[model samples]
Target: MNAPDRFELFLLQDGEKKITEKIFTGLSNTSDFILLKEDHTLGNLIAEHLKQAPHVLLAAYKIAHPNVPEVMIRVQTDGTITPRDALRQTCQTLVQMYFALGREFQKEFALRQFADQGDQGGAGNAGGQGGPY
Candidate 1:
């Protein structure tokens, strides 16, 4: 058992119940993390980060059922780091990335689409239906 992450606190927590982590048997350097009330987005994000990590050998997740908000992530790392640690690291990295992204967004929004510079993001639409959704 572990405390819920800030993102998880809202989307994945069941009152005081936090995310549950379990180490699977017969699998070297592999562990399973159960994220209650979670979904594919968070699971995929974490798995992508773990896959990008140098120490991670394999990372994947599954939801037993679509209606169920439980995500089980399996992380396997090289001997360099434990599966739990890899997951933790991925979460920390994601938090940092989100913070940086927020800051950058604020800075960009403060510029108001660079209106003063006459770069109105083209055709005065800025970001409309013509752009990628």
Candidate 2:
């Protein structure tokens, strides 16, 4: 089922395989999450989400708003954050929130973070020194 939206959610199932995909045009708005098909691998959907997000809000934010604390405070206070910074922070926070909610966006966010961590070349994998591993 196709709906007029920037994002659409789909699901596929085949024998013992099941996959879910959520597609969106941009990263700044809410759209319908359609459940599509019955059985298939989820590779396509994950790829699509990653593809759209970066070119749209994701890439823009990487430079515009790179700080998480400032973004968080700005979001809560609605204070004097620059337009670009505000937009970037908003987009990033929105994607993160959606993932936390276990929405279709989770896959895309997870994949992106995974790639980012890899790019960091295992720099900060270690957790809190105060805690046991």
Candidate 3:
């Protein structure tokens, strides 16, 4: 599928109830969206992943003091990390943190596509012989 066809469903669950909303997949899937949302949910998700990286504490320091010059300086001033070490750790962490959700998204897309392809008069998932997922 091309970029335009990519989409995601965000499911919010509260106890037994589920609230679903659709979001387009694109730049919106990245950190910028998290920064835009007033809700802390997305920020928490990013923070959770970021916390796993060695130099994330330095990033957190930078976040806390946005006006600080040179993250490497701030990271070292507190003692522990060297400039080179922090850079290497940050890059390694980011590389390891890349999570591929496309396969799962495609599976969801396939199931939705399958549902749409089925006979409308029958119960959902009832008419199809089997889905390819």
Candidate with maximal TM-score? 1
Best by lDDT: 1
Q: Tens-digit lDDT track for model 3 on 10-118?
A: 3322442221122223322212111211233433433444455453343322222433211211222122544345534654654454332444556667876677767
* C-alpha TM-scores of all predictions: 0.74, 0.20, 0.29
Give the higher-lDDT candidate: 1 or 3.
Answer: 1
Q: Which of 1 and 3 is the better model by TM-score? A: 1
RMSD of 1: 7.2
The residue-by-residue lDDT of candidate 2 on 89-130, one tens digit each, is 544765675566664345556665776677776555433122
Query: Which ten contiguous residues of candidate 3 have the minimum total lDDT?
Result: 29-38
Off by over 4 Å in 1: 1-16, 113-133
Q: Show model 3 residue runs off by greater than 4 Å.
A: 1-48, 54-58, 61-99, 121-133
- Report how far residue 102 has shifted in candidate 1, in Å: 0.7
Give the poorly placed runs of model 2, Cα more than 4 Å off.
Answer: 1-79, 103-133
Ranking by lDDT: 1, 3, 2
Q: What would the per-residue lDDT of candidate 1 be over residues 1-133, giving only the tens digit for each residue? A: 6864657424734464446779887688889889887788998989878899889999999989986778899988887989988888889988888887777766666665565457634555453222111
Q: If both were scored by TM-score, which would come out higher, candidate 1 or candidate 2? A: 1
